[model samples]
Target: MSTNNYPFQLGQDQSRRKFIYNFTKAAGVATLLTSPVISHADSFFVPPAPVTVGEVMDMFINQVPGAPFNSTVDTLKAGNRDIQVTGIVTTMFATIEVIRKSIALGANFIIAHEPTFYNHQDQTAWLANDEVYRYKADLLQQHNIAVWRNHDYIHSINPDGVRMGLLKQLGWQSYYNPVATNVLMLPTTSLSSLIDHLKQKLFIDKVRYIGDLKQNCQKILLMPGAAGGTRQIQAMGKEKPDVLICGEIQEWETAEYVRDAQAKGQKLSLIVLGHIASEEPGSEFMANWLKEKLPGMKITHLLSNNSLSFL
Candidate 1:
């Protein structure tokens, strides 16, 4: 890719403000107001306004207009209510570490990008009798923490909150193609050089690779979190990108397909940035977003420890 070929141009200060304004307006109040409610026994417990979980969720969906909520394992945790949520914390997953962080920050409500429970759907029915699950559940109950998931919602949101956050962190805001978030035309650089740059820029340690690093390709397709199905595969074939930057892949599916493609002499390479690494930036963006939405509420973002180790 030519240096001149980089598609985005950073806007001036005024332009950036306008961009933020437009982006927020486009996102709408629904995404901004989808916070958890709180209840208190004392006069101090009363919020300025009472809001329900469903109502906040609806608002979030409306604002984003494209978040995916159907596959969400559970919408609201077992015990949650509509009161004024005092503070909010956005996290990739509500692990033991995350819960502790939320409490330390004085955040009572958690908006998770992934599942609170282990599974994608976050079903705990089978774990009812399981000791480990019981222990985790009991901890939340003791803490008075309310958890709501925003998996599909963030994915479906326009510009994709996660992807947007990653791009912003990389200072690649102007490089996005006007046509789509996945398609980005960046300045000319070798694959290895780009990888090194990403490591430092993203501050990550577990980036996996599938394909030759020596290959030079300008147009890159970034499918963060996880790569999709056969249709997406076919589309990638058509695009014939130099590289596909993704969060993670199923070894039997996307990884296998990429291997086959390489054997067939395709020049494409797949860079597997860990799922959490790929999605964490978006969580950071969510913190900023929540701060804007609930100005009075304290918001913080917590990152998951990277899951991969190189031998």
Candidate 2:
């Protein structure tokens, strides 16, 4: 892509803020190190070590506990984990455009909420000969950009990072379920009206649903990300929400299940929000959470827009 096609730039305030932040950070670190040294063996480990990509990754991983999906996919996707980060950019997916934007913002690290290699596991065997994949990989290598997928852990976190981000975006924190967060009780509205509201809020014009436009929907079950067929169906069955807001739906499974249920006169609705729009907000939220964790860094959020577009 041409530099002319680059979509964003570092604003003046951000530049000035970053400069002041670095100056203050230097002073604080100097003071900490110069203060009286502790004599205990544990305390003698020193203070204020430089941060690296691996350190950041470990910080995130430690936030979620127990049996979350742990795999190589969650590890660093590109560049060196040992490299000291200049800045971080959180996004839904690490597309070429987002990568370009990160480079322009002087961010050497990217924390993505989705896969970079077009698949869940990001296996490259099938993409070995693909020219498109090669070009993107080449760009990553050339820039020495580090990318880490924060999917499994983010979802597994106590408050669920994606839900927290989306709620903040939608301003639905007041309506959030106190007992079961997955279940939301909305004010009664027609199915079509709710769809319209989602369309405007999420910037999604179209949606696939399993209910009549005139159907009344109040209770909603929000299942973001590809939670798979079993989990989606099970949630709807257990909660019996009037509508189920999902990131994705399988044609023959969950969608069909909902369709058959609706045909049987069951009060159920299903709205597909697509994968990117559903989880991207959480990645945008990650930028803020990361800012709090590693302050004084030039952290910014670059939206990894949906890959496909409607005509």
Candidate 3:
């Protein structure tokens, strides 16, 4: 579904990322520990233990100990948490179309990458009088659908699940650095070629870049979200990638840093893939990852198109 369906109101979630060493181990234990016991036909009677939407999400995202982003923001946005999920839809955003689509597909659980409500934390106290909010909330209640945002936790997943998904989409599985999840080592290619590759593979319409098109780029620092200027610069300086591929950045912030770096002839380059384009794949990655993790439930990745366009 399009972002426009949610009207002009939008939320920007701040994901504080912490590196964990063993995500697979953590996630696996979480699944086994949190999983609802399966009923075997041979057994006399093993009643299916209720596995609610919140339970599954908590298992998946809480793989890391002591999550910095509290449950007040990560908790359920709509519907009851006790409602058993028939299936799950993991998307970049739970837009109006996605909510209806999930319900149509008989899926009651939606694990979204962004806020279901207009605010970053999905605070409904302020939107109590908003008709759009009422309609959306009422629709979710009518369908008995529950929404949960996987913003901070997913990014904080040991291997940085978000980056893992992008690597899978970009076909750079072997290029991932074990110690540093954000860095990438690739064969030398021009800036334009890399951009073209991103557009073709990621299906992006437009991208913003800083550096000459003909400039040769090899080492890539993939920062897929707006991690702010200081972090962005620190990463760039540390890795010193030929090109920095990122999701979103303020023009006055990291963008200006790259611009000034280029003036100094450091040959540093930058590409902004917009917030949705960069992190969207992570949610899609999450869908695939959930299949093995949540055996009883079918998980689908609902693609959210970039909310911006260029004339």
Candidate 4:
């Protein structure tokens, strides 16, 4: 073979022994086999690009339609946005236990679905002197963990990310109404059985409901998280669902409406799934989404369990 065809030039005068020794020692058999010249490779393996907290936030913002809203509660609650994220944890809330777990997992970014402080806007000025607030804040600061609320943006998605997740968990995709994502035309079943189904799927020991056990149910209106009493009632009125499954409800509001509607011989009902339990699946969905979007990055979903327990 002509030496010109080879990547390296070989001299005829060189002994076969000397040629083999030079090739093995200088080029190395392994290197020659793996090298781009001999292997005809386009590129070598490279690690996934290092991602920052802000970049991941931007990915969500960019994907969400009508994002960069005029005002949003989806703000970073702790740590610097510029910090390089070692790992990510998505949760319903950044509770003390969740924060500790994130730290233990070596995750520096926490994408939470609700307020970190006790209120909607996460106003810390009022909580400045509060002991619990101070402790939670200090813990995040100590471990350099960043908590970002993803409330508005996640809900702003067309089908609503939280609702999509909940529907997926319920195995009701076939029953979902695309035009009215919250509405589901389930196969006719008793209200009690529906509640049982929800409890089983949601892994909840019990659920608070306002309806007779034997009442037949077909239409369902699922409003996860605290969509407020007025919104829930209005949806109930408009959709005229046989049952309204929601996160949390004030005793004097939607629950009362359901009671009165039932009194009037209306086929109406309500099931409260608690706020944390209702939205935790959405956080899990978010983590799963990020796993696909940023392959090779560590993303985990941890539940921020409900504080209430039956006596």
Candidate 5:
């Protein structure tokens, strides 16, 4: 959607004009506003009063360069990028339920930290002919919703948005290092007790562990949202952390390595908090940033339904 066909009337009054001007300035796209307001006949391609989808996407990527995922501006389907996004909604995953919630909040632009379509890449290859995928994609088209993934951008930002959220939620901001996105020191506690505390505090059900709870955990390495491969796992071991709190891990890789450490009698622990729970905080941070950047625009946050059910 371009500036010409903006949905909201920008030339109504002085206040409206000021609002648009300030919003464009905050978005760092004031140069695009040569004309006070522009309109287009393509109702499907509604642009936000003062901002464009490209600008919004650019703002997010530029602000959060360290995000873990990638985004694509594709025109594969009709009405995909035709929406004029007034407000922005941030979420871990842009599932159907989340999309519905965004629409109810009057936010047509969605900035998702994870994939909208099920996979990590948000690709629709397998769903190219799938009935359910097609229906979901069509629903988005009908509503004129424009979805963008801000994963990689957020991760690339110094300190990493996800890690920052985790630290904020844990009240460990003082311990966090902005340059390395690592914690200097955490309160000393038993591995088991720390696990229990995290479960109770986060109110999460799927917290899994891979160490002797009785061990005293003086130092812990935390990597939210998926453990790295064997090489990185080995490096983490060198750090001599009593425990490693990671979001998720492949069953055969980090998970098994932790088991091996246990077998070898190393007093190391691994806590798996699932990917969604690990990354949820970042979306909340995104919402706060949106509020700061676009003061006039209404902002809302939608959370993904828990994707895993354990026996």
Candidate 6:
């Protein structure tokens, strides 16, 4: 049979007939041949567009309760937005070790809570001739990794995502009130016991504290990150918590304030958890949230540990 010379397209007709026959036989119903499955067979094989960096960012920004802010530090610090994201890594900071780990894990996008560079704004112009900056920047370029700062957006969320994550990690959610996000009313425990608990929970060796070891602590002023000494002192003044659990503090500010208060017979204390240890939970929370939003996509939380060694 000269099929090529036929006026009617014989191959398409045979394919259609064969498809219907198979579909009917598999479905066990002859009437199912008229179903939309036959018409959609072509489209069923078409894969979805690969998720781009910009698309993921858009989805994230859109989901944030009151996002699309007029001004934000949450900008792409490295790499372009058009590239497709193979995987995501969330961390407290995109240190060189973390960046290398991300590369090893086959991740192309990094959502870091803090700046990648040594500055808050991540300005790289001044570091154009610096060796350390060049090395880090070259590593990112070689791996085609994109680093995006998520500081402002995460902090802007209701109840503060970082604080919520810390509460969850420390099992203090029961005592947390959204209205008073900075306060946690916990069972009465000694200051030393609380420090031990924090060290265990946050996976740290030691923490700098300024209170009598046996002093009882029930109310906690939860300031995870560096909220500045003035803010910390002011919050303590207003909330009057038994202990202030904060990240980092200047030598002369909050510490001196607590010292003066102690001299005056006021029951005040402070525990420094370090910046990374305190906010790492928030990045972990981000990883979990991303998994829900991007089903089937690989998302990991990398611990950006402090480089300083403790005796």
Q: lDDT for model 2, on a 0 to 1 scale?
A: 0.76
Which parts of model 2 have CA positions greater than 4 angstroms off?
Answer: 1-50, 67-72
RMSD of each: 9.3, 9.6, 10.8, 18.3, 13.4, 18.8
In model 4, pairs of residues that clash are none
Q: 140-200 in candidate 3: lDDT tens per residue? A: 9898998888777887777888988888777788989888888887777778778877765
lDDT of 2 by residue, 1-311 (tens): 11221112212123232111121121122222333576433322233346899888888887787743545468678887887887788888889998988888777899998788989888889999999999988998898899999888888887898998887655577888758989987767778777766655566768777777777777889988788999998888899899999999778899889989988889998999898878878986787787677656667777666678777
lDDT of each: 0.68, 0.76, 0.76, 0.80, 0.66, 0.80
Better of 1 and 2 by TM-score: 2
lDDT of 1 by residue, 26-138 (tens): 11122222325644332322222444545555666777663444555537763486634655667778887778777777667778888777887788898889887888788
Which parts of model 6 are misplaced by more than 4 Å?
1-49
Model 5 lDDT per residue over 1-311, tens place: 11222222223332222111111222322223233466533223222257666666666666553432344432122234445566777787778887777777767788877766777656688889998899889878878888877766676677688788777765567778654454345656666567655654444755888776667776667788754677448757678678888877887888788888889888778888888877877887778877777655667766674777889
For model 4, the stretches where C-alpha displacement exceeds 4 angstroms are: 1-46
- Evaluated against the true structure, the overall lDDT of model 5 is 0.66
* Deviation from native of the Cα of residue 24 in model 4, angstroms: 43
TM-score of the candidate numbered 3?
A: 0.81
TM-score of candidate 1 on Cα atoms, chains taken together: 0.78
lDDT of 4: 0.80
Better of 3 and 5 by TM-score: 3
Model 5 spans > 4 angstroms off: 1-49, 64-82
TM-score computed on alpha carbons, candidate 4: 0.85
